[model samples]
Structures are given as structure tokens and as C-alpha cells.
Target chain A: MTLLDFARGPAMQFAIFIFVFGIVFRLVGVWAMRHKRDLSEPRQPSAWKGGIHGLIQHAWPYKPFRDKLMTDYVIGYVIHLGLLFVIFFYKPHILFFQDIFGFGWPALPNGVITAISIITIGALVIALVKRLTDPVRRLISNFDDYFTWFVTTLPFVTGLATAGNVWWHYETGLAIHLLSVWLLLIYFPFGKLMHAFWFGVSRYTTGSRFARRGGMA
Target chain B: MSDATTTDIPVDLESKRLTVTRPDIRFDKQGELGDDERVQKAMQHFAKDFGYIAANYMEACVHCGACAQACPFYEANPDPKLTPIWKLEPFKQAYKREAGPLSFFYKTLNLKSKVTIEQLEEWQELLYDTCTMCGRCTLVCPMSIDIATLVGMARHGMFHAGLVPHELYTVTEKAEREGSPLGATPKVFADRVEWMEDEHEVDMPLDADKADVLVLMSSIEIQKYPESMAATGKILNQMGKSWTFHTEGYEATNFGMLSGNTQWQKDMTMKIISTAEKIGAELVILPECGHAYQALRWQGANMLGRPLPFKVQHISEFLAEAVESGAIRVNKVDKSVAFHDPCQVSRRGGATPAPRKILEALGVELREPESTGNLNFCCGGGGGVITIHRADSLRYKIMGNKLEQLDATGAEMMVTSCSNCRQNFDDSGEKLHWDKQMNSLLELVAENLVEDTKS
Candidate 1:
């Protein structure tokens, strides 16, 4: 098979299987583990409110750490929301979803999607620069952190290359973008990217635990 | 005076310094030193101790660095190692290798470095001395990682590895063997209570069979600040509450918590629970000791495998409830004061509003700092750091952040509900030559009690 065909077929199937299976396995395994009962009576009656509060409250920077994290917070939100918009609303991306699920949502205008993709690439670059330059971020970051950043940024870079038809044939750029996405899917469950699933669980557990004690998360 | 001038309580700076710097007793190293066997044991403990919430926290952290900004230790020194999440490196490695998704890969490839004795030795300061387990980092983490909970889990691993600081190790050993961290025996506690009773001209019910409340005191209050005990007696008496100090479990502070030994923590908590049960007390009152409140009120039920038969309340919480219900009447004091929220009681234990209520009842002009209530800075002497002699300089250094907050308040008197916090303020206040007078909230309430009942 040609490189493009293989990248579009077998590699895509393998990546999806691993992404779905690996996430489920890890999450279920975490849940299956025996948790010691919190025998202490809660000061507050229900922990669910705290858990729900935590899910929403953590979306923004906590008040005490607000000033220190304002820049990261703004850039991070733009990158995350922009990527979501591009993934779900772009015509080509929705076509892939429609092919699998037999349904698709309304697509954004190609020009708008292109603008968001470019902005996302810029945000990711800025994030990478901050990770490399800021002393605290640099200190805590490991090889996995940089690797995840690189893999996540690749599809965006490749998509922009295809859209603008820069540096290579448009078909080749599209093929490379598809391959980069496969790499991310396979790498997602093994590294810090697992935080996508764990963040909600962590925040809910924490919020509930603290709420039960009559404190906000 | 603008309610900001109060007489400085004459403190013998030199002797007080000596009491903290040179404790009368020393903790001799007890067990075998850290070795390969100990490292393996610690790694095993890390694997065994973690449950669902801990695993979630371990995997959820994205290295956002928000926690580092909230940590007083990191803020004081700006050291990367003192970063809250960074301090969890050892525990994280053990988790990755043993229980994580990539454990099989780690076992087959052996890519990670082994947790060495030297590394564990170095981490002693990071885990025990530098960090206060104050939960400030837990509060600021965007992922809600509960870094402080995992820090305690790391301490549990360290404790199993025999890597606890000598000071904490000795104190835990003493508490395990002698029933008190300070070696205050049953007789000693009884004598102090008798002396305070005589001094205050009040009857301190001792181990009464069926009292409505059981009052528990820290060994520090008995040995160092007996006036707090006297003050508690006065308040309880004025409220017409039936309370007794149980000789069997009067010591509220648990060194087990300080040392991170789960078994010891369970044992100490059981002692208090059993004593309260034996006395048929309806409620148990923890003194102005922060960790004691954490040990008894928060972790007590989990340790005992059941909910406590009697309710546990911090003295501040009890007083707040009393003042709110009009069970106790107090004349407002004409002084400007800043209330220091103890980490264990306010942030960790969820008693933030109670102390503020008590302060309002006192009628003092309350001055709040940039960080107050749940986000208050630690007094730097918590989590057994105060007991570790070698950690003195680091503690004093970290106190810079708290001192700056208090200074900004411009309050004449600084009042806190925790004895450990009070000791920290006293020691650091003397060293920094701070002018604000340090007072206990319970004592202040006692002094300002209204004798005539309007009802």
C-alpha cells in the first residue's frame, strides 16, 4: 500500500482502538481499586454539590494564585477552546466523524476554521516557549512533558501547512497531519495527557472531600 | 489610641528562645539507618498505601506551577525542590514503577532510576522539614490534585523507610511508649490541672463518670502554657457546662500525625476515643492545638473504623457556638487584632468561620491580611517542623512570608486558635523583634467574659 493509503487506513484504525481501549482500561482500573471508606462524618450533608462545584471551579484560576497564573490561564484557554472548535467544527474533521458515526454537526466556514487553527498553533508555540523558558515550569517539566507538547502541536502545524499549501504538496501535508494525529492518540493514554480524563475525577474527588468537611475546593 | 495599642506582655526573649532552641530532652536515633532494604520497604509502602483518590491525584497533575506560588516555603526561598508537586517526585516514581499504567514497561525496561537511600535521605528535609503539609498547595492546584494528601502519603512511605527526622521519630516513640509526646505522664497532667485549678479557684472535674463534655489538652498546654488550661476552665465554668479532663487521654497532640506513622496515629486516636467512650461524654473538646484537631476531628473516625460515638469540636468552634447561642457573654475588647487561621483547623478541618465568629464576639477591630480565612499562610512551625531542631533556620526563613502578612495588618495584638501556631509566632516574633503582642483566643475570651447575665 502507498504511505498515504496506509496512514489513512490501518494506522488510523489502530490508533482509534488503542485510544478508546487504553482510556477505558485505565479509568476502570482506577475505579476498581478498593478505596478505604471515609468513616468520618461529613460536616456538610452531601458531597455531590462539592464535587460538581469542583468540576466548574477549577476551570478558572483560584483567586490566591490568579495574578501569578493570569498569562498561562488566558493562553491555555485559547489553545484548548480553539483546538476544540477546529476538531469538531472544521469541514474535513467533521467528514471523518460522519464517516464513522454516520452523522456530523454543522461545519464552520473554512476561513474561520483556518483562522482558529492558526491561532491555536500560535498559542501552542507560546506555551512551548513558556515551558522551556520559565524556571519553575522548566524545573518540573520532564521529557514526557515536551514530547506530549510536540506531538499535540504537530497536527496543527501540519494542518496549517496543508491549508496554506506551504512547504509541500497539499495531499502529502494532509497525510502527515493524519499520521501526527495517530501518534497523539497512541501516546495519549501513557503520559501526562492522561490528565484529560484524570482532571475531572481528581477535581470531583477533591471538591467532594473538602465540601464534606465544609470547605470549598 | 486607635484600638491598635496594647501593652506588650513581658516575655523573657532569651529563655523563650532557649526553650525552643534547646529543648531539655534530645531524640536519639532509634532504628537502623536508611539502606537498600529501607528503600525497598518504602517503595512497597508507597504502593500499598495509595487508594483511588491518591492515584487520581498522582496521575492528574499537569505541572501547572500554581501550587508553587501558594506554597509559603517556595515563596520564601524560591527553591524548585520546595515546589509542592516537585516534592512528590519520589512517591510518583514508586507509583509509576509499581502501580501505574506503564508499570509493565518500567519493569521490563528498567528505565527509571532506583529510589536510592541517599535520595530518600535528602528528601527527609523536603518531605518533613521544609513542607508543613498545610494544604495551601492543595487549595491552589487547578487540577485539584490534593498535593498535601499525597505529601502525607509520601511521609507514610518515608516513615516505613525509617527516614523520619530524629526529632519527630523520638517524639513518636515517646508518645507510643509513654502515652505523651512530651513525656507528660498521667501524674504530671493531673498535677498541672490541680495547680491550674488552685490558681484559678475553680473545680476542674477530673474523669467524671458521666459528664456532658470531655476536654482534651495538648502536652504543650500542660507543660508550657498552663494559663490556656486555666482559661478553658474559666470559660467552661462561666458557661455552666459539665466538662471533665480525662487523665487517660488528656494529651490532644498526636506525634503519630507529625511523624506520619499510621499505626501510631490510629493508636493515639483510639486512646482519646476509648477514653471519651468510657467517660460517657457527649462531646470532646480539642484544645488550641492544630494537628491535634486534625488527628481527632478529621482522621479519628477513619482510624477507628467507625464514626466517633461522641462529637469532636475545636475549642474555637465550641466557643463560637457558645457565643452565637448566647450561652457565654463577653465584653468586647478595645484592641486591634489579626486572627491567624491555623492550617489544620481552618483550611484542612473546615473551621474557618468559627474563629472569625469568636473574634467578632470579642468586639476587637479585626484586621485581615492579603491572605486570610482559608488561604492564610502557615506560621511555619507545623507538621512536626517545630520539633525538628535542625529545621530551625528553615522555619525562621519561611516565617518571613507570614510575618509580612501580619505586619501589613498593622494590628497591635495577634491572636490564633492553635498552640503550635502560637509557639511559632512567639519564636519568630522574638527573633524578628516584632512589636505585636501574641495572645491566645481562648485566653482573650476568658479575660473579657461578662460576669453579669442580662437574661
Candidate 2:
């Protein structure tokens, strides 16, 4: 089979398997652990509402931290929002989604997606520089942090290169982009990249806990 | 430390100099536990606490470091090691090795090594001394990881390992053994209550049978700030509430919770719980103590493995209700005052409005700090940090942030409801030469109480 064929068939299938299995395994592993029930009478009465509130509230920095970490928050938002746009709003990505989920939504123009991609790549680069320069981030970061950054940024770079036909044939660039996506999928459930899913779980837990205590969750 | 003043010595022709030294604050080792035993105990306890909440929190950290800026220790020292989440390194290590989904791989690869005795010793300061469990980090975390709760859980492991700081360990031991961390024994408490009753001319009830309310006092209130007890008595009396200080469980301070001794925490909580049950109390009013409010109001039921039979309200909450309902009237004082929100009671305990309500009743001009309510800076002395003399310097440094916030308010006087926060402010203020004094909300109300003389 050709490189693009193999990449689109076996590698994609393998990555999907690992992604599905790993996520399920990781989630079940956490759920299987003992859960201590909150038996105290809730000051706010509804834990689930608190949990839902927490999930949405943590999307931005707290007001006091906003000015101090303005650059960090800006870059973080840019990178996240950029990726979200490229994934859901790009035409090719929409086609891929339609192939998998059997549904499609209208796509944003190529110009907008390209602009978002460039900005996202810029933000990703800045984020890496921050991880390397800032003491607190440097101290807390590990192989997981750097590797997740690379895998996350890789898809954007490869997608952009495939679309622009930079330094390779269109088929070859597409295969490379596909492989980078596969790498990200393979590692998503195991590394800190799993934060995409677990962040909401944690926020909900804290929100519910503090909400029950009548805290500003 | 020594002053420039010289002393006259008869034997010597020249004057001699006198030198003074600060009190020695050192770690006191617990029983003859071996390193292996301590490590074993710590790891086992860590595993026991590896529940869903912990696992999710641990997994959720994206290393954004937003929590660092929120942490007063990190802000004061600007040290990466003082980062709030970094303090949980050893605990996270234990979790990954023992209970995480990748536990097998981690164990086989030795990726996360077993927590060593030396590591536990190093973390003693990080887990206990620097952290106040204030929940500021919890509020600021983008992932909502609840770093404060994890720190508390980490302390449980540290306590089991006998790796707690000497001062904290001693205080917890005292509370566990004598039922009071600061030696406010039942006899002492009764005598103090009697003294306050005579001194304040309020009918202070002690060990009353079948009272509707059980009033709890922190050891600090009983021993150091006796006026709090009198103020509580006065408020209850003015409101015509049947309240009594039950000697069996009068101490509101929970050093067990402070020092991370789970059994001791449960025992201390049960003392108050059983006392309220015995007295057939409809409500249990916690004193102006932050952690005490936290220990009893939030964790008390969890400790008892069920919902508490009696209602728990922080003194501020009770006072707020009384004043708002006009059950107790307060004569307005013609002064503007800044209210210091205690970390645990206001930020963590979720009674931020109660103290403000009391301030409104007193009709003082409430000058708010730059950061108020849930986002207020800690007094640098909660979570039993004030009790540890070794942390005094660091605590003082962190207190600078609080001083600036309160000072910027430009209020005439500052009032706080929690005795622990007041104690911290008192200690820091004295050493810092700060002119403003920290006042207690309950006492403020007692002093301005509009007595009910109606037949």
C-alpha cells in the first residue's frame, strides 16, 4: 500500500482503537476507585448545579489573576480557540467529521481557518517558550507537558503544510498530517493531554464541593 | 538578637553587652518509628485517600501555574518550590505509583519512585508550614483542581507517617490527649466563663441541661480572648436564646484537622457532636474561629459518616440572622471600619455575607479591601500556621500582603470574626508595628448591644 493509503487505513484505525480503549480504561480506572459520599447537608441544596456552574466558570481566569496572568491567559485562549476553529470550522475537517459521524455543518472560509491556524501556531510557540522560561511552569512541567505540546502543535503544522504544499507532495504532506493526528490520538488518553476531558471532571468536583459549602463556586 | 543598650558589670572595667535569643522552634520527633515504617505508613495513608476527587484533580492539572500567583507563599517568596500544586508532588507521586491507571507501568519503570523518609521530611514544611488550606488556590485554579483539599488530604498521609512539623504535632497531640490544644481544660473553661459572666454582667450558662443551643469556644477564645465567650453569652442573652457552653465539648479549635490526624479530627468533631446531641440542641453555634467553623460546619458530618443531627452556624452567621431579624439590636458606632474576611470562615466556609450583615447592623462605614469576599488574602496564620513558631518569619512576610490590602481600605478600625485570623493579625501587627488593631465582630456587637429592657 502507498504511504497515504497505509496512513489513512491501518494507522488511523490503530490510533482510533488506542484512543477509544485508553480513554475508556482511564475513565473506568478513576470511577472504580472509591468515591466518598458527601453526607453533609448542602448549604446550597444542589450539587449538580454547582458542578455545572464550575465547569463553565473555570473557562476564564479569576478576576484578581486576570491582569497578572494576562499574557498567559491570552495565549492559552488563542491556542485553544484556534485549535477548536481549525477542527470544527475548516472544510476538510468538516468532511472528515461527516465521514465519521455521518453529519456535516457549514464550514468557515479557508481564509479564516488559515488565519486562525497561523495565530494558533504562534500561540503554541509562545506557550512553549513560556514553559521553558517561567520558573513555576518549568518546575512543574515534565516530559508529558513538552510531548503533549509537540503532538498538539504537530497537527496544525502538518495540516497547514499539506494545504500549502510546502516542502512535499500534496499526498505526502497529507499523509504526514494524518500521522501527526494519529500520534496525538494515541497519546491523548495517557498524557496530560487528557486534561481536555479531566479538567471538566475536576472543575465539577470542586464546584460541587464548594457549592455545597456555600462557597463562590 | 540583641539591642544596642549596654549593661554595667562590676567585675569588668568596661560595660558589657547583653544578647537575647528568639525561642527555639525545632521539630520534635514522634515515637521510635523507623524510616521504613514511616514511609510505609505515609504511602498506605496516601493510597487510602486516592479517591475519585483526588484522581480527577491530579489528572486535571495542565501545569498552567495560575495557582502559583494565587498562593500567598509563592507570591511572598517568589519561589517555585512554594507553588501551591508543587507542594502535592509527593502525594501525586504516591498516587501514580499506587493507584493511578498507569500504576503498573509507573511501578515497573520506576517512573514515580516510592516516597522516601527524606522526601517526607522535606515535604513537612511544604505540606504543613507554608500551606494554610485557605482555598484561594482552589478558587483561582483554571482547572478547578481544589488544591487546598488535596493539601489537606496530603497532610493526612504526612500525619500518619509521623512526619508532621514538631509544633503542629505537639498541638495536635495536646488536643488529642487533653481535649484542648492550648490547655483550656474544662476546669479552666468553666472558671473563664464564670469570670466573663462576672466581668461582663451577663448570665453565662455552663453545662446546661436540654438547652436549645450549644455554644462552642475555641481554646484561643477560652484562654487568650475571654471576651469572645462573654460576647457570645451577651448576644444569646439579648436574643433570649437558650444557650450554654458544654464543658465536655466546648473547645471549637480542631488541631486534628489542622495537623492532619484523621482519627483525632473525627474524635474532636464527635466530642462536639455528642455534646450537642446530649443537650438536645437545635443549633450549634461555632465561635469566631475559622478552622473551627470549617471543621464543624463542613467536615463535621463527613467525619461522623452521616449528616449532623443539629444545625451548625458560624457565630457571624447566627449574629447576622439575629441582627437582620431584629432579634438583637445594636447601637450604631460612629466610625468607619474595615472588615477582614478570615480565610477559612469566609473564603472556604462560605459565610462571607454574615460578617458584612453584622457590620451593617452596627452601622459602621464598611470600607472594602481591594480583594474582598471569597478572593480575600489570608491573614497568613490560618491552618494552625500561627501555632508554629518556626513559621513566624515566613508568616510575617506573607502578612505584608494582607497588611497592604487592609491598610489601603483607609478605615479607622479593622474587624474580623475568626479568632484565629484575629490572633494572626495581633501577632503580625504587633511585630510589624502596625497601629491598627484587629477587632472581633462578636465583641463589637456585644459592646454596642441595644439591651432589651421590655417586660
TM-score of each candidate structure, all chains considered together: 0.95, 0.95
lDDT of 1 by residue, B14-40 (tens): 333212223334332235544777898
Candidate 1 regions exceeding 4 Å error are: B1-30, B452-455
lDDT of 1 by residue, A95-156 (tens): 99999999988999999999998888889899999888878888988878889998889988
Worst 10 residues of 1 chain B by lDDT: B1-10
Q: Write the per-residue lDDT of candidate 2 for residues B7-71, one digit (tens) a residue.
A: 01011111111011222534444656788998998998888889998998998889988889888
Residues A77-182 of candidate 2 have per-residue lDDT tens digits of 8988898999999999999999999999999999999999999999999999999999999999988899999999999999999877794578888999999999
lDDT of model 2 at position B175 = 74
Query: What residue runs in model 2 are displaced by over 4 Å at the alpha carbon?
Result: B1-25
lDDT of each: 0.82, 0.85
Model 1 achieves a DockQ score of 0.72
